[model samples]
Target: MTDIQLNMDGEPGWEPFDAPALVGASLRFVSGDRTGNRFRMRYFRNASGELVARVWFGPETEGPPGHAHGGSIAAVLDEVLGLAAWAAGYPIVVGNLNIHFRHLLPLQTVVQVDSEVVAAAGRKISVRGRIVLGDRIFAEADCLCITLPEEQRRQLG
Candidate 1:
């Protein structure tokens, strides 16, 4: 389903769509499973209009015997960065993503994620995102999203 089809009703903000709902819907769109029980992601608007989302990794997302999986971290980065672009009013596909793994993130701990739009050129959008635990950063990513034309996005459906 497309973004329009996944439109959630009666959102809290109720103006330009709730950021958390939008992210949750997009996660459901990509992952195909909405636990809706635990491991919630909260959203809020920054001064620059970027929608930030945070997820606390726990029993729900585990790998490597004890900590979060590498893929899971990337997924969160990509999702948040893409949502950053989409929230900026430019829907796009993943182009390139580079992440730096700094620390071993513990499971069942709160990990903060923040994404912001840096620049847009034609069909490309550059964004930056980071996953942080308290004052320490676990991973950081810089992504390039390929903006799709209306026709291309339509074809994906």
Candidate 2:
């Protein structure tokens, strides 16, 4: 097993997210799975308050050759983009997720995911995000999220 070193202190213009606060709260499936060990994700918020995540694709996520699986990439996009909506103050669940893969991501590589809430109309929210390694974009995603009903939100809380 390879040792993964993470900078717990976030990158410039961003702040580390409190993952424990979200576990079992809104992101149970993704953030609460401690045993699968497919990825190590660190969340942050940019200076403009957009949600961002720095992710390390672990060996457990391998697919074609030494690259990360497409499904793993999509999972990251789903969680990051969904949390982006929540960070924007919309209690939401993903209604639709569309991802375009631009390049193959290598396993064990740390990548940056940047997300922003693009539009909001009533209960529907549109978010755009991308996974990148420096100047190269690995994938881009657009997500439509639906706000949970007040009753459901209260039940979750």
Candidate 3:
């Protein structure tokens, strides 16, 4: 039997990050199933402390034959981008996510999601991210997030 690769914390220069620690089960829809075939996601922080994710789109996420659905891709972006804000110490909820699909993503392929917190203005935070495999960019998104109030933030956790 072949073992499924479910986690990536041991990769060089990457550290394991627990999103559930911050938001409880709020991110469960996209990233919750670690062993399921729908989506397999492993969260990490690179050497620079930037949030990154290794995500696999399984057969259940397919739209076109052999390819993943655009909605599936967008959902991953929404979760990761919003988590990017939380990882950067801003407890936030995604208000808007603008995505541009550049290429079709094949199901069962692992791709990297790299995210950055670009700007912050009072209660608002902007995050930019991409789903890519090496030099090939599959999708890119800019997420607008709003900082949650202290009470609301505590409730999320």
Candidate 4:
């Protein structure tokens, strides 16, 4: 196993966050593999308190000759969008996810995921986000999150 230095620059005023501290080991699927060539992610909150991430799509995520698979992109979106609601103080689980692919993301490149909670009514929370490299968007997504029932939350922990 080798360490791959994350190739992301923190934006001014962005507050770095520890996702595991908020969501615990549940995030291991997407954010784990610290030394493997899979997905490497760093989380933060922008000045406006929106959830943001800098993710490196390692060579292991390749689907096409040199790009990431659609499923891989979706998986990251699911985790980030769901976590967005959690970071905003909603203990939730993703109920539905809708994604639109704009471009094939190149493997071994670092991109940004910008997400925000759009609405919350009762047990439902809506979040929208996108994967991008500068002005080029690789994918866009909307996630519907359902607040975990008290019993369900207890069971997960």
Which candidate wins on TM-score?
4
Q: For each candidate in the order shown, give its overall lDDT on alpha carbons.
A: 0.70, 0.84, 0.90, 0.91
- Between candidates 1 and 3, the one scoring higher on TM-score is 3
Q: Where does model 2 exceed 4 Å of error?
A: 1-3, 6-9, 23-28, 33-37
TM-score head-to-head 2 vs 4, winner: 4
- The pairs that clash in candidate 4 are none
**2-82 per-residue lDDT for model 4 (tens digits):** 233535656899999889999889888989765578998889999999989989998889999899999999999999999
Tens-digit lDDT string for candidate 3 (47-146): 9898999998999999999999999999999999999999999998899999999999998888999999999999999999999988999999999999
Residue pairs clashing in model 3 are none
Model with the higher lDDT, candidate 1 or 3: 3
Ranking by lDDT: 4, 3, 2, 1
On the 0 to 100 scale, the lDDT of residue 129 in model 3 is 100
- All-Cα superposition RMSD per candidate: 7.2, 2.5, 1.8, 2.2
Alpha-carbon deviation at 31 in model 3, angstroms? 0.9
Write down the lDDT that model 2 would get. 0.84
Indicate which candidate wins on lDDT.
Answer: 4
Model with the higher lDDT, candidate 2 or 4: 4
Task: Give the clash total for candidate 3.
Answer: 0
